[model samples]
Target: MKELAGKVKLVIKFFPYRYRDYSRIAAEAAIESWRQGKFAEMHELLIKRSPKLDRDSLISYAKELNLDVEKFTKAIDNQEGAAIIDRDLKLAKELDLYVTPAFYINGIKVLGVRDSDYFKNIIFKELENAKKK
Candidate 1:
């Protein structure tokens, strides 16, 4: 992943649960569109839908951040990046997670994305329980 992408991911980790819905649908839509050669249209939709994410200015911004401009751009343009997104969605689906940002503990569903604290609580409990098995 590009360095900036890693930072963006950490920031995303703090988003309030309610703000993360439809991630799967949106990611799939984006990947599918990009697969169909609608890069410009996809870029427009991203701008219209995610004002904070200014897709149009990403390249310049990445360069400003001192990231590898060519590599970053190439990553986004390839199937790998989108496939990574798709893999995440597929895992979520396999876990029977219908809602965005859902988590599971020992195969038990834990809903919502309230905060890191919520995930920590379930994960810790599950880890303890698993020790007995």
Candidate 2:
């Protein structure tokens, strides 16, 4: 994907499940990290340490990433990123998306887990279509 970075713009939207007790908080923490220019770092950490998204754990991760722990704590505590997360949730509902890994590539929807070959095929097809246009 890094090879296509300049050609493809990847936009990540948060759609944390309500049933997952720590989903919302983890989303908030990611947003906080985004504010501090550490979104990717925090995202990777959260994924690697799933089900450990307690406040202390999140703060510890932030500290590990050398982020401003105080600011991160305040943002999560105040739920500063709730609006963004809520908007994503609403969009997911409107799109009838109930899955974690849904993708919309040039209006083509691919849902569920897919392997690298699947993505490569999609991207190649899209690129060919783009060339034709």
Candidate 3:
């Protein structure tokens, strides 16, 4: 993404797994971190330390990231990101997405992990298509 920073934009939408025990809370923590401008850090921690997204773990991550722990905890306790999550869930359902790590490049649905070239090829194709318009 850094390579294509100026030519591309990345928009993240949450879609926590309904069956996972901590997915929703993790998503909430991520959203709260975003509010504090620490979204990337929290996201990296959450991914690196999966299945440990309990309240304590989240608070620890917040503290580690130097975020306002009080505000983060309050937001998590209040489920402040629920509405946003719900909205994104609805959109995911509409798109028939049932998996994590799904991405839509220029409205093209790509699932799971792939090499950078896989994405760059799609992005380049999309860029060309846009130019044709």
Candidate 4:
């Protein structure tokens, strides 16, 4: 993504699987981190520690990021992230997305895990298409 930093924008939308016991909570933690301007940090940490996304671990990650732990905890407890996540989930459903890590480049939906080269190819193609226009 850094390679296409200036040419493209990345938007992250959360779609926590309802079956995972901690997925929704982790998503809420991410939203709280985003509210504290530490979304990237929290995001990385969550991904790295996905197996341990319990409530305590979530707060620990917030503390590690030096976020306002109390605020984050309160926000998660209050379910502040629910609305935004719900909206994203609704959008995903409307788009017929049933998988994680989906991508849409120029309205071209690409699903499932893809290598960096695959993304680069698509990105370069998009860039070229943009130039032709």
What do the candidate models score in CA lDDT, each in turn? 0.48, 0.93, 0.91, 0.92
Judge candidate 2 against the unseen true structure and give its global Cα lDDT, from 0 to 1. 0.93
Better of 3 and 4 by TM-score: 4
Q: How far in Å is the alpha carbon of 68 misplaced in model 4?
A: 0.4
* Model 1 residue 102 distance off true place after TM-score fit, in angstroms: 1.3
Where does candidate 2 have its weakest 10-residue lDDT segment?
1-10
Tens-digit per-residue lDDT, 32-112, candidate 4 = 999899998999999999889999999999999999999999998898999999999999999988899899888888999
The candidate maximizing TM-score is 4
Every model's TM-score: 0.44, 0.90, 0.87, 0.92
- For candidate 1, write residues 1-133 as lDDT tens digits: 2322322211111112235544333443344444445544654555465534433355454454454557556654453345557566566556666664554455566576677677567666755676798
Scanning candidate 3 in windows of ten residues, the lowest lDDT window is 1-10
**True-structure lDDT of candidate 4:** 0.92
User: Which segments of candidate 4 are over 4 A away from where they belong?
Assistant: none
Which candidate ranks first by lDDT, i.e. highest? 2
How far residue 110's Cα lies from its native spot in candidate 4, in Å, is 0.6
Model 4 Cα displacement at 51 (Å)?
2.1
- Show pairs that collide, candidate 4: none
Question: What global local distance difference test value does model 1 have?
Answer: 0.48
lDDT of 2 by residue, 24-120 (tens): 9999999999999999899999999999999999999999999999999999999999999999999999999999889998889999999989988
lDDT of 4 at 11: 77
